[model samples]
Target chain A: MTRKIPQIICALFGMTLFLLYFSQHPTARNLNLTILNDYFQIIFAFTLLVGVVSFVKVNLKAFERGEDRSYHLVSVIGVFIMPLLAIIWGIKGDSPFMWVFENIQVPMQATVFALLAFFVASASFRGFRARSVQATILLAAALIMLLSRSTIGDMIADQIPQIADWIRNYPSMAARRAILIGIGLGSLTTSLRVMVGIERTWLGGDK
Target chain B: MDAGTVIAGILTLAILTFLYRDNPVYKLAESLLIGVSIGYFLVINWSNTIMDLMFVPLFTQGKLMLIIPLILGLLMFGRFNRKTTVLSRIPIAVLIGSGAGVAIPAMLDARTLQQMSATVTPILAPDGLPNISELVVMAGVITTLIYFYFSREHRGWWGKSATMGTYFLMIFFGTTFAYTVMSRMSTFIGRMEFLLSDFLKLTQ
Candidate 1:
C-alpha cells in the first residue's frame, strides 16, 4: 500500500503538470503557478537540507572508519562554520560570511576549475594523435578551432578565423541539433514512462 | 595586503600544487573546497529560499496554504528513519513527477520542434543561387540523424551516410573539446594573474 500510493501520486501529479502546460483556463494557470512557484520552491529548499544531512552522514561514517579522518573533520568544520557565521553575523555584503565566501570559497573553486587546464592539456596531447582518417579530421578541426581562438592565429592568417566560424556554424550546429532532437525524444519517452509507472527505479528498492 | 588576499593566494597555490603530484595538502584543499561550497550553498538557500520566501511570507503574509509544502518538505527528512523511508518517496515522487512534466513539453518545443524548423531553411539564398553552406548544413543534419538510427544494419548507402555522420560528429566533438580547453586556459590565466599581479605585485 505504501509503495502503490506514492506511485499513483507520481503518475497523477505528472499527468496533471503535463496537462497543465497546455491549459488556457485561468484557474489551471493559477494552480500551476502556485504549485510551481510556491510548492516546488519550498520543496527544493528542503532538498538542500537533505543533501547537507547526507553529506554529513557520509563524512561521519568516513571519520568513524578512520579513512582520511582529518580531511573529513575539516570538511565538517567548514560546512558548520559557514552557516554559523551566517546565523550570527548575517550574510550581507560586508558580513563575515561574505568575506569567507569571497576569500576562501571563490579562490578554491576558481583554482579547482583552473586545474582542468593542466588536465585538458595533458589529456589532449595523449588523445589528439591523428591515427585514422576520422581522427585526422577531428585533429584538423580542433587545431583550426584552437588556432582561431589564439592571438597568433590572427597574425598567421585572417582566413583561419573564417574557416573556424564556418565549421562551428554549419557542421557543429547541425550535429548539435541532431543530438538535441535525440535527447528531446528520449526524455519525452522517459517522462511518459514515469507518468505511466512503467519506470519504477525511483521507487528505490526491489518492488 | 589584507588577510583575505593572503589566504586566497595560499589556497590558490595549494590547489595548483596538485598538478605536480597528489599530496595531503592537495587533499586538504579539496576537502575544504567541498566543505566551503556546501556550507555556502546551505546558508544561501536557507536565507534566500527558506527564511525569505517560505518562513517570512508564511508569517507576515499569513499564507496558510504554504504549510502543505512545508510538511511535504519535512517529510523528506523521514528517509533517515528506516521505518519511515517509504514516506520520503512521497516528496521524491512529487519532485520527479513535476520536473519530468515541466521538462517534457519544453524539451519537445525547444529542442525538437524548434531545431527541426531551424534546419528547414531554404537552401537557395535571396540571390536565387544554392548556398553551399546551407546545403552542407542540411546534409550534415540528415547524416548525423541517420548515424543515430541504430535499428538498421549499416550497409550499402546507409553505411556511407552513417560514415559521413560520424565525420560530422567528430568535428562537433573536436570543436567542443577545443573550446573547453580555451575556456580552461582562460581560467588558469585568471588565477595566475591574481597570484602574480594582485598577490606578489610582480606583473600588471
Candidate 2:
C-alpha cells in the first residue's frame, strides 16, 4: 500500500501537468501556474536541504573515521561559518559572506577551470593525430577554427574565417540540432514511461 | 595590500599548485570551496525562496493551499529515518512527476518543433540563384538524421549518406573542442591577469 500510493500520486501529478500544457481554460491554467510557481518552488527548496544533510553525513562519517580529518574539518567549518555569517550580518555587498564568496569561492572555481587549459592542450596533442579519414577531417576543421580566432588567419588568407564560419553555421548547427531532437524524443519517452509506471526506479526499493 | 586580494591570490596559487602535483594545500582549498558553495546556496535558497515565497505567503497571506506543499516538503526529510523512508518516496514521486511533465511539452516545442522548422529554408536565394549554403545545411540535417536511424542496416545509398553524415559530425566535434580550448585559455588568462594586475600591482 505504501509503494502503490506514491506511484499513483506520481501518475496523477504527471498526467495533470502534461494535460495542463494543452488546456486554455482559465481555471486549469491558473491551477497549473500555481502548482509550478508555488508548490514546485517550495519543494525544490526543501530538496536542497536533503542534499545538505547527505553531504554533511558523508563528510562527518569520513571525519569520524580519521580519513583526511583535517580537510573534512575545514569543510565543516566553512559550511557552518558562511551561513552563520550570512544570516547574522546579511549578505550585502560589503558583508563577510560576500567577502568570502568573492575572494575564496570565485578564485578557486576560476583556477579549477583554468587547469583545464593545460589538460586540454596535452590531450589534443595526443588525440588529434590524422590516423584515418575521419581524424584527418577533424584535424583540418580544428586547425581552421583555431587559426581563424588568431590575427594570423587574416594574414594567411581572408577566406579562412569565412570557411570556418560556414562550417559552424551549416554542418555544426545541423549536427547540434539532430542531437537536440534525439534528446527531446528520448526525454518524452522516459517521461511517458514514468507516468505509466513502466519506470519505477524512483521508488528506490527491492520492488 | 587589501586582505581580500591577498587571500584570493593565496588560494589561486594553492589551486594552481596541483599542476605540479597534488598536495595538502590544494586539497584544503578544494574542500573549502565545496563546503562554502553549498552553504552559500543553502542560505540563498532559505532567505529568497523559503522565507519569501513559502513561509511568508502561508502565514501572512493566509494561503491555506500552501500547507499541502509545506507538508510534502517536510515529509522529504523522512528519508533520514529507516522506518519512514517509504514516506519520502511520496515527495520524490511528486518532484519527478511534475518535473517530467513540465519538461515534455517545453522540450518538444523548443528542441524538436522549432529546430525542425528552422532547418526548412529555401534552396534558392533572392537573386534566383542556387544557395549553396542552404543546400549544405539541408543535406547535413537529413544525412545526420539518417545516420542515427538504427532500425535499418546501412547499405547502398544509405551507407554513403551515413558516411557523409559522420564527416560532418567529426567537423562539428572538432569545432566544439577548439572552442572549448579557447574558453579554457581565456579563463587561465583571467587568473593570470588577477595575479599580475590585482595581486602584485605589476600592470595597470
Best by lDDT: 1
Q: What is the DockQ of candidate 2?
A: 0.77
Error of 1 at B124 (Å): 1.1
Residue B73, model 1: Cα distance from true site in angstroms: 0.8
Interface RMSD for every prediction, one decimal? 1.0, 1.3
Q: DockQ score of candidate 1? A: 0.82
Those runs of model 2 whose alpha carbons end farther than 4 Å from true positions after fitting are none
- The per-model DockQ list reads 0.82, 0.77
lDDT of 1 at B32: 92
Candidate 1 lDDT score at position B161: 98
RMSD score of candidate 2 (Å): 1.5
TM per candidate comes to: 0.97, 0.96
Worst 10 residues of 2 chain B by lDDT: B133-142
lDDT of 2 by residue, B80-165 (tens): 88888888888888988887887789888898898889889998999999988878877887888889889888889998998888
- Per candidate, the number of residue pairs that clash is 0, 0
Best by TM-score: 1
